[model samples]
Target chain A: MDQKTAGLNIAIFFCRQLDANQDKNRRAIEKELGLRIRFFPLPCSGRIELLHLLRAIEAGADVVYLVACPEGACRYREGNLRAKRRIMFAQKLIEEIGLEGARIEMVNKTAEMPADIGAIAMELLARDAKVSISPVRSNAVASFIEK
Target chain B: MITAERKPMAEIRAMLAPYRKILVVGCGSCVAECASGGEKEVGLLASALRMDAKIEGRTIEVREMTIDRQCVYEFIDQLTGIADRYEIILSLGCGAGVQAVAEVFPKMLVIPALNTTFIGETKEPGLWVENCRACGDCKLGYFAAVCPVTRCAKGLFNGPCGGSKNGVCEVDPDSPCAWQLIIERLENAGRSDLLEAIYPPADWSRQQGKGPKKIVREDQRSEG
Candidate 1:
């Protein structure tokens, strides 16, 4: 769900935090950016699979930034660690296919650094501005997933 | 699990250039786990080929089909009537699936979109690593379940070769010494006696080289 109507046509869903920390992270991004940021409150960063990241890109997400907790502070032990590896893998796949992999970004922020969230949002926005997506001109997405 | 990667778009598109009618087949078993030849991958490849080829006159009809297990006969039969509609079948399955499709539709041309790699497991999501050699004789019982024949660079059946150093293979530091693991396991199990059993030199003819092997259980067979 979104709180604001973004001036920019598109924005990405940045997944971060788990359980109780989830709502707080979402509200903070909505309050600070005033941009339509899709916040996916994941159980843990470890739960964010590679298929999720690839599908997000195909689904027209302008940018996907993972806001992870400090490396050691992850309550799920290796949640942030797993997310980092999946991003690296997805990045390599994109790069190999002649596409820029910068559409996905990862940032480490503590709960106390409220401004870091805003900074990351703005950074992603600036990056998105530099990159141009050749809009998918297909009405035949109906037969897209036949398999 | 199996490890596989997508064939380069250019190469894949080039291979299907002769055929105007294409059937993109996906195997949901091995290649699916590898994230290469699954339904999603088949779709992506079909789209890329359509976009890149820009073929005209003869319509490039891509009919996508994925079988639960392309290696099995019952699953391959699912393509019955659909097989005749396409000029060429592009398989996303392993070597076995391509053969199965060809066997089922002998008249049609079959092309593989994925290079079958090895029996592997997901070291992590999207990252698959080879772990089994499928040696006719099982040795995991002797090696703490880690198959040195597969994980080792040289496939050492005995203890670590001179190439092993600091518990790592000499061929690559990233690889753990499989023999070392075997020794540690053997020592822990107090079954060091099994180590001296010098495994007889493996017979290559009995395994994959035995030609297309088939197993039929006579007891399970029924005469109609």
Candidate 2:
């Protein structure tokens, strides 16, 4: 709340099905939170592979969250289930690498709850109030990003 | 199919401590089907190791490669020229795969990243239970398609032990008595006559021991 999460980038990979009006809903959250979010709209939650999550972190996403359709309601039968499995596996990988497993999260929601999605971003990106530029990024790149 | 489980992370880290460069090899056959030493697992493990190295402020390089079947020389041969890039190799294949790679690259150090557990069936996704012993001598015909060598706790062939209480093993109540399964299956098949026929001791020579085993078809051989 005290501008702790001001500079950290939170990447949200949402199933496009989660919000019927993907652009408007995504932009509303982006506008509400301003520059903090970089939304990745996936056709199905199954599209969120472990490599994608790890790559996001390697690219300096301060936090990565997978917002999938509710469990039994995946548009593609069981993409959400597949996404859940990969997310769990990814969490283990992140935990071993020296980051909190909480850095990657998997939560289910329907397409209409833009506020719910925003709430998760606010809660998580805010928890680590100490978001400085990531150690892997140079001050030049960091400052460049800030600009 | 040969089955295995990834070694605990702590043990993997200890073995990996000696190498700055590592190549994690995954098998795409049995281990893949069981969800242990597959392409997905290779990525998960390699990523974990890299992250651990980054956190310690140490440099560790990990590369991942998956072969169609790590036990075959043809597929394993693909790793030949490229494998030397790393100082050590972490094979996610079953025991056979680790040895296959070792046999090919005798000069390279190949380490097993999984504990070769048993030859089993994938009862379900993420669930594996021993179903076959591959005991050269096939006894499934006599046992009504059930394998006594793998199912029986003692590998008993003749009959159920007296310790079977209500069709559960005495050694482990949670385990169903393998003989009970055979007997019930026999009764259903109307082949209880085989139950009365005593099965002599199995030929242990064909099953295990005595160095490496080989099967050669003279027709398939290129030379004498």
Candidate 3:
């Protein structure tokens, strides 16, 4: 039985170095969508290791995403890129567990793009509301057994 | 340092098929540098295996442990207390380390989760190149600090053989001719005198020609 769409849970990890002001957009998105959002403020995207991504999933997150600064925009230089590689590795690990790799993602949007952050959360929540995805890029996705 | 690459997951799963409990051991030395086996790798592999077993509707327990160097007896002895809890030890160390664990825990089943590649150095991030053969001999002083046994395709003592062109090896275009590099280094060092001094055929005894090699260091030997 699929959980109610209203209760869709998503976890977001954002780099604090990108912007010190996500509270306004985060509150607005949560209020607008009526969805559960757990926002984690990290100092740098390099701190977002694969274990954190896996642990978030294991802790009952429907979808986990990292909003990293645009490439070459990371204050620490390549912190965003490092997070991208870690998320890709996490996706591979999750795929081995029969979970869709799409469940984990790292979007390159600057802190200036709070609208994009809210938009991404909205898009993923919409996707999670429907059904768990098959590996979206795989040939076997056609055979996904939807509940 | 000794370098190794992680074995494929399918093969690792097959090896653990019969065991309910496993200890995925990692070494903090060489394999770690090569990104094959280390603390991070141990946890990653353990998590992957657990997820695989769960997804397949099976039950398996895995534990992770990484020590300074798995090839040393004292380090292997550290696992003595907890070794028997698991049915198999999936070692992520080089070949010597895997064998070392087996020798220490004579009764337990041990297996290598990495293919020990060679003695080498990291050329760049995520890129490693083999640079030594460990012939139990050191001739680096004569060859301008480059090993023909490793860099040269033929391991020829006197080289620039019938195949080098544009400074690339005949067997592998990606590799620059080792002799060319040696000559350049010699010329730069003003050690052209060393060129006419042809090195005699290296004694094969230093190599792994006979059985297992040994060094009897009476200076460092402990009294029985």
In CAPRI terms, where does candidate 3 land? incorrect
lDDT by residue (B1-224, candidate 2, tens digit) is 88898887878888889899999999999999888899988987886776566556567788999999999999999898899999999999999999999999998899999998889987877789988877888989899988989888899999998999899999889889999999999999999999899889999888786887778898888864
Best by TM-score: 2
Off by over 4 Å in 3: A1-10, A23-38, A57-63, A91-101, A110-119, A127-147, B196-198
Q: What is the lDDT of residue A44 in candidate 2?
A: 98
Model 2: colliding residue pairs: A18-A111, A19-A111, A97-B51
lDDT of 1: 0.68
State the weakest 10-residue window (summed lDDT) of model 1 chain B.
B50-59
Q: Each candidate: RMSD to true structure? A: 6.4, 3.8, 5.3
Pick the winner on lDDT between candidates 1 and 3.
3
TM-score of structure candidate 3: 0.83
lDDT of 2 at B156: 93
List, residue by residue over A1-147, the lDDT tens digit for candidate 1.
Answer: 222323322333344542345455346556755433555556667777666665555444445667777888788888888889888876665544444577566666655545444454545555425334412212123121222
Please give the distance, in angstroms, between residue B63's alpha carbon in candidate 2 and its true position after superposition: 2.2
Scored against the true structure, residue B62 in model 1 reaches a CA lDDT of 82
Each model's TM-score?
A: 0.68, 0.84, 0.83
The prediction achieving the highest DockQ against the true structure is: 2
- Assess each model's interface with DockQ, reporting 2 decimals per model: 0.10, 0.31, 0.21
